[model samples]
Target: MDWSSKTVMVTGATAGIGAATALRFAEAGATLIITGRRKQRLETMADVLTSAGANEVYIHRFDIQKKEQIAAVVKNITADTLSVDVLVNNAGLSRNFSPMWEDNTDGWDDMIDTNIKGLLHMTRALLPGMIDKNSGHIINIGSIAGHEVYQNGAVYCATKHAVKAITASLRLDLFKTNIRVTSIDPGLVETEFSEVRFYGDKERAETVYKGFQPLTAADIAESVFWSASMPEHVTIAEMLVLPTDQASATMVYKK
Candidate 1:
C-alpha cells in the first residue's frame, strides 16, 4: 500500500486511538486530515503529525455529534479539493458504567448521538465522494461490546452493536463498487476511554487495568493500518482484537 499519495481522515484525533491511528499513517508519509472537538489539541497534534513524516496535516475542529458541523467540515474538505481516501470513524465513547435503569438519559443521549448518529452523519457526508471516485476505505472503530454485552453497559453496548451492523450493511451496499468497509473491534485498550467513561474519575479508571496487561492505542492503530493497507482485491472485513489477558468483553484475567 502506497500511503504517500493517500489522504486519511480520522475523527477524534486529539487523543487516544484516534491520535495513534493518525500517527501510524503519518509514519507512512500519508497526508492526514484530523478532526476533533478540541482546537488547541488538534493544532498541537498537527505539528506532531508533521514531525512524524506526514506529507501534510490538516486539522478541523468540530464535534462529530453535531450533524451540521460534520456537513460543514465535509464541505470545507471538498472545497479544498481534499478527497479522503480513507475515513476512520473513531469519535465515540461510553458515558457511564451503570445499569440502564439506574442511568439517566443524559449519558444515553451522548452515547447514541456520538456513537451511532455521528458515525452515520460523517459516513453519509463522505461516502458519495468515495462512490464517485470508486476508490476508498471505511474503517470503523468498534468494540468487543458489539459482539457480546456486559453488565451495566447496555446502552454503550447497543451503540457498538449498531456500529457492527452498519459496517456489515455498508459493505453489502457497496459490494459492487471498489470501496471497502471494515470494523476494527478491540477488547481492552488503555486510553482516556475508561477515564472518560468514569467521568474523569482517574482512580476508578485506573482500577480497570490494574490487574492485567491491556492493549494500547498503538496496538489497535497497527491493526487498523494493516486492515486498510491490504490489496484492493482483499478486504479485511472485520477484526476482533483482544489482549492476552482478555477473552470476551467480560472475561479478563487479573493477575
Candidate 2:
C-alpha cells in the first residue's frame, strides 16, 4: 500500500472530509487532483497539499452538476495520465427538512443532481481508464441515511441509497478488471453537513449532535485511507461507521 507514487482525484475537496482526506493522502506522498466549485478554496487546498509533501498537486475549478464539465475534466485527466489510481466521490448535497408532501422541488432536484447524477458522471467519465489499467479504487462517501429513512429526509435518503446501490453494482461490474469499489457509510458526522441541511439554522444543526460525540471529518478520512490502502485483492465493499452512543438513523440516544 505504498501511496507515494499513486494519484488520487477527490471531488468536493475544498473543505471538511474531502479536504482532510486529501491532506492525508498528500502526507503519504501521493499526487493529488482535487476539485471543487470554489476557485479560491481549491487553490488554497492545492497550496496546502504541495506544502505537505505531495509531488504534484492539481486543482480543477468545476461544478459537479455540469455533465459537460465532468466530461471535459475527464478528457484533461486522460491527457495527463492514462489512469487515476484512486477516485473519491465526496461532493454531494442535502435538502431542507420538509415532509414528503411539501413543495420542495428545488431542494429535491439539488439532492438528486449532486448526490446521484454527479456521482454517476464522475464514475462513468474516469472508470474507463481504470478498467483499461486493471487497477484502481473508487470510494463513495455515503451516509447512514442511505440505509434508513429519517424524518423529512426522503430525497436525501433516496440519493444516498442510490450511492449505496451503485457502489454494489460497480463492484460487480468491475470484478474482472480488479478495480475495487467501496462505499463508506458514515453516521452522525459533525460537519457542515448538518448546517447546510438545516439551511444555516445553527440550533437545528446543534441538536443533530446532542448527547454524543459524532464522528469528525478526520475520522472518515482515516477510514477512507484505510479502505484504499488495503491489498489489491481485498475490497471493503461497505463500511458503516457510527459514534458509540448512536445505533442507527432513528436510534440515536440522547441524555
Candidate 3:
C-alpha cells in the first residue's frame, strides 16, 4: 500500500498505541500530523516520525477535551492545504478502578470527556472535509470494554460503549458517502493506561501485566495500519483484538 500522498492525523500520539500507529504510518511514507497534550513528548514523536520515513511530520499540542483547541487545530491544518486522509481518534484514558457508588465523580468526568466527547470533537471537525472529497477513513481506538462490562469499571465501560455506538452511527450516517469508519477494540495492551487508572501507582500498574504476556502497543498499531490500508471499497468496520491468554474483557487468564 502506497501512502506517499496520504495525510494521516493521529490524536494521543505522545505514547502507547497512538505513538506506535504514527510510526507505522510514517513507515508507509505518509505525511503525519500527530497531536497530544504533552508538548515535549509530541515534539519527540515528531522527530522520530520524521526519521522513520514520514514524508512530512507535524506536531500539535492540545488537550482533546478542549473543543476550541480541536477546532483551532483543524482550522490550522486546513489553512496549510492539508486534509486528513486518515483520522485515528486515539486520545483516551482510564482514571480509576472502583464500583460506581464508590468511584470518584472526577474519574467519570475524565473518561466521558476524553473518551467520548474528545472523539466526537475530532470527528466533527474533520468529517466534513472527507464528505466533501467523498474519501477518507476514521479508525477509532476502542476497547473490549465497549462490548462487555466488568466490576469496578462501569464508567470506563460506559464510555467505550458510547464509542461503539458512535462508530456504528457514524458509519451509517456516512453510508451515502465513500468514507469508511472502523473501531479497533483491543482487550488489553500494556501501556500507561493502568498507571493512569491507578493514579500513578506504578507498583499496581506493573501487576496488571505481571502474570501474562499482554498485547503491546505495536501489536495494536499493526491492526490500525492494516485497516486503513485496505481497499477503499472495503471497510473492516469493527475489530476485537486480544492476546492469546485473553478471552474477553473480564476473562483474562493468568498463569
**Highest-lDDT candidate:** 1
RMSD to truth, every model? 0.6, 1.3, 0.7
- Give TM-scores for every candidate, taking all chains together and pairing residue i with residue i: 0.99, 0.96, 0.99
Q: In candidate 2, how many Å is residue 5 off?
A: 1.1
Residue-level lDDT for 138 in candidate 2: 94
lDDT of 3 by residue, 1-98 (tens): 68999999999999999999999999999999999989999989989999999999988899999999999999999999998999999999998798
Instruction: Name model 2 segments beyond 4 Å from true.
Output: none
Residue 207, model 3: lDDT of: 94
Residue 193 shift from truth in candidate 3, angstroms: 0.6
Q: In candidate 2, what are the lDDT values of residues 45-90, reduced to their tens digit?
A: 9999999988799888899999999999998987887368999999
Q: Kindly report which residue stretches of model 3 are placed more than 4 angstroms away from their true locations once superposed.
A: none
